[model samples]
Target: MDPAIEAIRTFNRFFTRHVGAIDARFLDTEANLPEARLLFEIARQEPVQANLLQAALGLDRGYLSRMIARFEDRGWIMRDRFEADARTRPIRMTEAGREAFDKIDQRQRAAVAHDLNRLDAVAQDDLVQALTKARLLLDPDAPAEFIIRSARIGEVSQVAARQSILYAASHGWGRELETLEAETTAAFLRRFKPGREECWVADLSGTMAGAVFLTDEGDSLARLRLLHVEPFARRRGIGGALVDECVRFARDRQYDRIILWTHTVLDAARRIYAHHGFECIATEVHHEFGEPVQGETWQLRLTA
Candidate 1:
């Protein structure tokens, strides 16, 4: 299995348990998780159309219908007909529904606050940042933007360290990967060329979102190395943008072609490269990252 898949699953398990998602009734309320979430969404989008509500929350039409019926039976909600759209009635909470929702909302907030209060101030802030990043990464369709800039002082090491840390934690990759990243980073910095070679770091509002290095191999050849996007920043086109920057620079420098080596497990990076016109030219299976991995070489020939 891909390490990314495992990492996501692990996080999902931990987070669901942490938030009491497994409880029969959420926060000891009368509703389950799905019911509570739909109730909250309905309240948030007051006077929402039933169709629009189902689409927004992605609840099954049948399930939504039943839940609405249940709520109506409890006198917690009602539908109002308006002349604006005669096709369907708009759904809204009754006075009792609002009261119930408010009580549950207060209890949920208090529960979260109580848990947060157990941690120090710094830990609480860290948790918030982590959650925000995770949410962004998981939402592929969400709007996002990142800036590409030259690697700064100390950032070369920072990029390499992050690569090591991420791979080690996600894939059970050992220190060999760490040593290799450190060595390559050192080489890039030691033989740095102002224009002939470059390293670009993706910046997301002062955060290190990703990094890629373009190296000038002798004889008009270029090598793209160490391309990665932080997990929270993936699916946001940062990887493709980095590859584009490389191609642009290689063309500017008169390189004949660009080559990159990456594992088959990196499906996202591979797709980004392929979308940018890079083709897989060769592959070999090896046990470099504590498992049998198919290492692939991708190439893109520059056109004059």
Candidate 2:
């Protein structure tokens, strides 16, 4: 009767019916999971660093090397040393690989759509709504495989600088810089409960591309704070993963709510928060750095 076991069974059933067919038709024909994953990564047309892929997929170095080798042999992807750094190698899909991946993607989408179409319009909407809510609710209490490890203390300053610059530039914080006291910023971090606060730096290969933080505000509330992804890490789902970790941590701790702060200028962070069912509950114009700025508060309720 355990919920975890029940969820596992539910997923196993779903995967058995949906995943088996897709895997057999697409992945089985081309290669194993690793190869197919690499193919998809290359097909994205982004110069993916090998170490990034390794961390994202959580594969052993030897296994990833073997997977890349197979793709190289098949000419599905081309590996090139990073232009800025010869030591780092990034990969991209070849023209032929793109064409192949398109077919595979189309087939998978169609296969998934076919089943969804079986549900009536209202039922489909209901299903989607239910799933979205379930995900947020389940996420807060989920066990985390990744731990909040250490980060360079300097990165905190770097992240804050980038965030403030970007925030000010986009949001017209002309004099706001004067209001943002370094002491206040330091205090915010300093307030974190030592035993409960956690920070994780996501190292994409050798690059520290993103960071996330979780802070316990009270017994029933936790604040997911200071999630930042470098410009280079944008669109890679790094931000989403970081937020998800915070949500999971809160859930595991039985927190009733998870809260975060942002200004209107941070659209990407707002979107991620919205996607995870966080809603803006309060807004105010505050003076910061000698400039007036609008700040927003958002909260995701973990309990119904």
Candidate 3:
């Protein structure tokens, strides 16, 4: 075996052991890593449908069922069958299980953060950048040329809905569904007024995975919003492409500057915007959803 691969495997084993996630604690059963992983996955939401987990994790149906059943028996999880679809079942965390999972998760995040914090800030940034570059390089296995075009009325709703779900889950904003629906409807409506706003979508192998919008704010400025890349399509140049398109559009449209707003917790998006020449213009402490988040505004100058 390659030395690097061997070293990585060794480090994974050592790390898991030290974190009490390997031998004597979390993964010590017929359930194994899959069940433990499922517990962590369902911990984020009120309930997770079986199909969602199966698709998200790309797990075998039988394997998922068996692991879920084990957790069910242990009283760590409960599965409820859907009346609309007899074959569909959803699993939710019990109060006891959620408490236990949160405890473990906090420990894990603390451990990871502690080690990262040991490095200087520059070194930490470099590490993340390197990792991101590596993933980007390794991720473009899908050889098909993705189709880039404007989002249609028919598909805009679903895209908006998915984007809302992602944001809501990340921010714990229960009302995001209503807020995002209105925003999506508005953005879609703006598409008809081509001079005011432009929304672009990327379709990869018949699936839409990336989207972005540019809205004219005034004579000198444009607003970049609704930038989203689906999880499965990340690291494949979709996001970078969308950003590049935005920059070019702003320049061509004679906008002097482009401004974007986002939360600080979205580190990857921040990095992407930064790499594309966006500078932090303003930041404010704001509470949204259930979390106290720092909202940042970034600006990019467009020169002729």
Best by the TM-score measure? 1
Deviation of model 1 at 201, angstroms: 1.1
Residue 89, candidate 2: alpha-carbon lDDT: 69
RMSD of 3: 19.3
Residues 1-304, candidate 3: write the lDDT tens digits. Answer: 6998898789779866765565445533333445567777888654778888888789998988877776777788876755576236567888767766767677667877987989997688667645544444456554545667887665666666767787776666567444755675665575555765788888775556778888877777998887888776777788888988888888887889999988788898898999999999899987655457788999998875
Q: Can you list the residue pairs that collide in candidate 2?
A: 140-251, 141-251, 175-291, 176-289, 177-289, 178-289, 179-288, 179-289, 179-290, 180-289
Name the runs in model 1 displaced over 4 angstroms.
Answer: 1-144
In terms of lDDT, model 2 sits at 0.69
The model with the greater lDDT, 1 or 2, is 1
- TM accuracy, model 2: 0.46
Query: Across residues 1-304, which tens digit of lDDT does each residue of candidate 2 receive?
Result: 6998998788878876666544544533576445666677666646888788777778898888887787778877786853765226678888877776776777667877987889997678557645544553455333222323446666556556655665566665543552452443465567856656666676553345567777777768888777877554456677888888778777877889988888786788899999999999999888664566678999999999
Pick by TM-score: 1 or 3, better one? 1
TM for every model, in the order presented, reads 0.56, 0.46, 0.51
Give the per-residue lDDT digits (tens) of candidate 1, residues 38-74: 7898899988877887888888889988888888898
Of 2 and 3, the candidate ahead on lDDT is 3
User: Against the correct fold, how does model 3 do in TM-score?
Assistant: 0.51
Better of 1 and 3 by lDDT: 1
